[model samples]
Target: MALLALVLLAQVPPAQADPPISQPAGPHAVGLRVIQPAAPREAGLPAQVLIWYPADTSVSDAPPLRYGDLMATRLSALRTDLSATQLREGRAQQQASLMRRLGVSGQAVLDAPLQARSQAVPAPGRFPLVVYAAGVGGPADENADLFEYLASHGYVVVSSVGMGADGREVEETLAHVEPQVATLQALIRQAPQWTAADPQRVAVMGWSWGGMSNLFAAARDPQIGAIISLDGTREPALTRQIDVQRLTAPWLYVSRSPDTIAQIQRSGIDTTFSLLNAAQYAEVTQLIVYPMQHADFVSRRMREASDAGYGEYSRAEVRQAFGMVALYVRHFLDAHLRQQASSLEFLARKPVANGAVPHSLRIDIRPPAKP
Candidate 1:
């Protein structure tokens, strides 16, 4: 039966995958570049930082960014135990799956010239800076789509490789948190030097473990004007330790569907305590996306996963939800960092009012506690 299943899987023809994520609604063209910061060798920071910012050049003829290459390299490192024949077969299968899932092309053009550098000389104004923190031990570009979208919409997005204190697999402890926080602070400090980033309007966005790290960064650095978390900061063990008084930035927490009582009990998660609840000092907006699991928060994972990966939700539905996530992040940044009345009003409305599918999301907004 196993052999027959394998044969059937191989014979299945690839269907047309979903289209690339929609072009952002921003007026500016997008550009991507990598910067290598000069830090003392013993400081233990990432060697390269990826920056996506509004560009002046046309991307019409530029080659689409190839995310598959990065995925393939990561996969190869993890599959060293496979025999040569098995490895080849696995690669072939992966290629086929990718064709059927989403094509490997990402939205950004590689090393595209900065908006200021291009010949099309636009107005001279600094854009808000957003420092992205990837999941623990994840690559810097794990949320490439979100970064690209934000860049197009007039923000300078910066990120570095997510690593632990020992520079290996990140464990869930304060030790692991220290390095990630340091990296985010370093990126914030370097954003202005590398690009036209507004130091006063900085935001930190994180996924999973990086999400928790951003909270720590905000607690220590008041300059982080806003916070965005993707299905992050649910760990009771970790959230209990955050100094919520210092975490006064307006926060947007996008979470997955709530766990059932039985599931919560089974996992030993304390349902009574929550970081969001504890954060009475900041204006908080909680968006619960029903179609997404924890892994689905990362656009790259959503694009790469198989049909089973989405579970009950169709690929189209999940894709739409992912797009909605991007939109919410943009609006949140705009509302807080840019102080745009339109975006602030957009966020003030319910998801349905903002054009989200009915019943797809549950949103709760909490105004900051009166001091």
Candidate 2:
């Protein structure tokens, strides 16, 4: 029976006809597809995924492309146009501000399952799936640059557009998150290019609010082998989650202290880390708080020159964050997803600068909530 199901599933392609395309799609912009259930599919919530990657080969002798990179030439173009002055000019770091300031002036609605539809450049291929969520009221593609960053490195990154606060009431974001996760898993399980991917090696990442949801999502789904928080700290979602034991996956929760969601000061999220039972903040999980603030984790300033945004760390500091996110996710996923050898440095805990360290993170390995 299982063999028959596999045979039937194999016949289905990764996407439907008139496929929903990835933004900046093509060999030039080409990364991969986010497998999506038809927007109007009669089922519950529809699903979709979009991914980008460094091609099997590059046109020039530039440095090997980074994840979410269009390719060396393209990134170089964006980078070359960037200048220190431009980087410090305006609120470029506040992705929301930058987005609002540069409103979708010329975009045409594209009709997505969740989004109002805006212009998206189409690129396609088989790659890893990196699921992304937006900041508070932020568009799904608001962080395309980041998604592109990961996709270019040879992964299919999906950014789900949930209900927005723009012109509508914000429904519970969780409403559709699970279906999206399911869709992504289906794409991996049934995607045409699963062979190019390490099935066991998928990662869920998001900035701010998305990050919080992903943290909770990771806890709930054991199949999610790795979890990443880009400048997001534990809030009600990660810290005070009701069903604590529902989560057990290894996490790389990275954040900057000053950023709004970076640290939930009121909730005492930091305490969750240090207070966890030794087994809770066990070897499998780790969290790192950067000296920099939230914007520092996003290399947006690196891509576009401007500083009129949340205070920043440094291109060098922000760059450190990018590297760490990629390195850790790469390491964890590679080992678990690809079933291949990878450095466990990411999983290692470094000693504190102060000799008075009792615990690095405060986590309590408590039992599951009563039904």
lDDT per residue (tens digit) for residues 1-371 in model 2? 99999888865432211112222222333333333445423433223334444444333333322222221122222133455565444223333443354343101111112211121233344455566655554444444455544544456565544333332433444543444344334443543353344455566777765666665566655556656666653443335542446555555555554335644566455544431332253223444545346544443333333334434354444444444444455555555445455345334434232211233222111332333
> What tens-digit string does per-residue lDDT give for candidate 1 at 1-371?
99999889755533212422453447777666656556523444477777778776444443344454334434433223467787667656766665555443222211122222222222257899999998976777678778878877899898877888766788888888888899888788877987889999999999999888999999999999999999885778888888998889999999988889899889888777788989999999999999888888886675455666668787777777878888889999999998999998988889988778899987889999976
Clashing pairs in 1: none
Model 2 bad stretches (over 4 Å): 1-37, 40-49, 58-128, 142-149, 164-200, 237-239, 258-284, 287-291, 299-305, 310-312, 339-341, 346-371
- Can you give the TM-score per candidate against the true fold? 0.81, 0.53
Stretches of candidate 1 exceeding 4 Å from the true structure: 1-20, 40-44, 57-64, 69-124
Q: How many angstroms is residue 35 displaced in model 2 relative to the true structure, after the best TM-score fit?
A: 7.3
